[model samples]
Target: MSTTDVSTNDIVGAPVATTVEDVLSRFSGGNREDLIPILQAVQNSTGHLSRESVLAVARHLNLPPSKVYGVATFYNQFRFQPLGKYHIQVCRGTACHVKGSAAVLESLKRILKVEEGQTTKDKLFSLEVVACIGACGLAPVISINGEFHAGVAPDRVAGILNVYRRRAKNG
Candidate 1:
């Protein structure tokens, strides 16, 4: 066995069973063909493909780190960072853009102190810009974890965020 055969706890720097080692253990062999499936499995369990996890996978499969990272970056489905409790997706399609979604997105960034594709420091929110959410009628819309909010305005960003904050605090 290779040095990569170390325990999952040893590999992840955490005792969790969902580490790269745990995922790799479920598959046999180190064939190059297993790359995508391995990535998908790791991401499915971990919510995101962390840098350490990717490197661990490379070692496990005997592939270069660049090969793994190249494949992961080629796919939009892969995320480098873990998502926040509330994943915020802002629609920036043509209709939403015409309806002033850019201003709405700016407000969200300022209020959350996070740029697109980044989670807030408190881990309460993550922001993403999507081409569309299929809510053209509700232009300038954003969705919090798939729950759509329509007709969002720049000034209303604070009130909208406060609602989620209140719920989290109260709960």
Candidate 2:
């Protein structure tokens, strides 16, 4: 696994949540204007924004939790839950849409039994739909932790998921 993959930190405990406090310290005395950067840093450190961390951030910034949530939810860049071991990003950009990526996305959702932006109960996978993956020529694409699967059709999603499932099982 790459060292920089934040998904490696998909740990459940106070330890992971505590990193938010460390990130908040960097923005000590900062105000609401610092909310975005603070959130980004926290997510970078903890891999997501948990309710505990969000409350801490609210306290640190002297703002309401609702305000912090408002900003985080407003932007697509923020994630409120830890990424699963496999982070699946489906492209829904113009080119991807034209190529029927939406069907591929729905296939994944149905098979995974989780909606977009959620991790599976096993914590093995999480789904995200991004505006673009920058592989326009490879429209209808999905990537697992930055490894692209190009020209994906709805039927292929299960096979792709099985590949990862087998890997996890074998290891």
Candidate 3:
């Protein structure tokens, strides 16, 4: 989205994204309690709800910026910035750990050439670590988006990443 679309009133000194007004318009005639939905709308527009977006939301709802920021930060899924298209999460639970999850993690870092929570320079992928995905049966599981990869070997990291690479290219 273009950055020119958002404007800030004198009350709040945050720069809203261009899509904030469209998001606000979705429930223009609704109740003020639609704060959560409003935030979600802003997040969808900008990938993450930025401080500016929250301020715009607060202004729209006639609520406090602190309150809007609090709610946005309280949710783990919400991000205050844009994220890459692909999200890769590796399982780090005991079962996976015993089965060489650390090696898997290391392999991923080497292959992707990025640290955990870091996105590839190309913006094609973002890597992260998860405690567990409850798929202990498949120890050392890795997830690309929501697709599960059980019984992952450090050797297979390249191939797995290649699958996403190919998919990204094809899509």
Q: What is the lDDT of every predicted structure here? A: 0.79, 0.81, 0.74
* Model 1, span 1-171: residue lDDT tens: 232232332112122347678888877788788788778777767767899989988998898999999999898656677778777888899999999999999999988888776788898887878787688999989988667899999999899889999999998
**What global local distance difference test value does model 2 have?**
0.81
Residues 69-118, candidate 3: write the lDDT tens digits.
88877865455645556777788999999999999999999988987756
For residue 130, model 2's alpha carbon misses the true position, in angstroms, by: 0.7
Residue pairs that clash (backbone atoms under 3 angstroms), model 3: none
Ranking by lDDT: 2, 1, 3
lDDT of 2 by residue, 7-66 (tens): 433222112544776777778876887787777768777777889988988999889999
- Per-residue lDDT of 152 in model 3: 96
Which candidate leads in TM-score?
Answer: 2
Candidate rank order under TM-score: 2, 1, 3
Error of 2 at 99 (Å): 0.4
What lDDT score goes with residue 42 in model 2?
82
Clashing pairs in 1: none
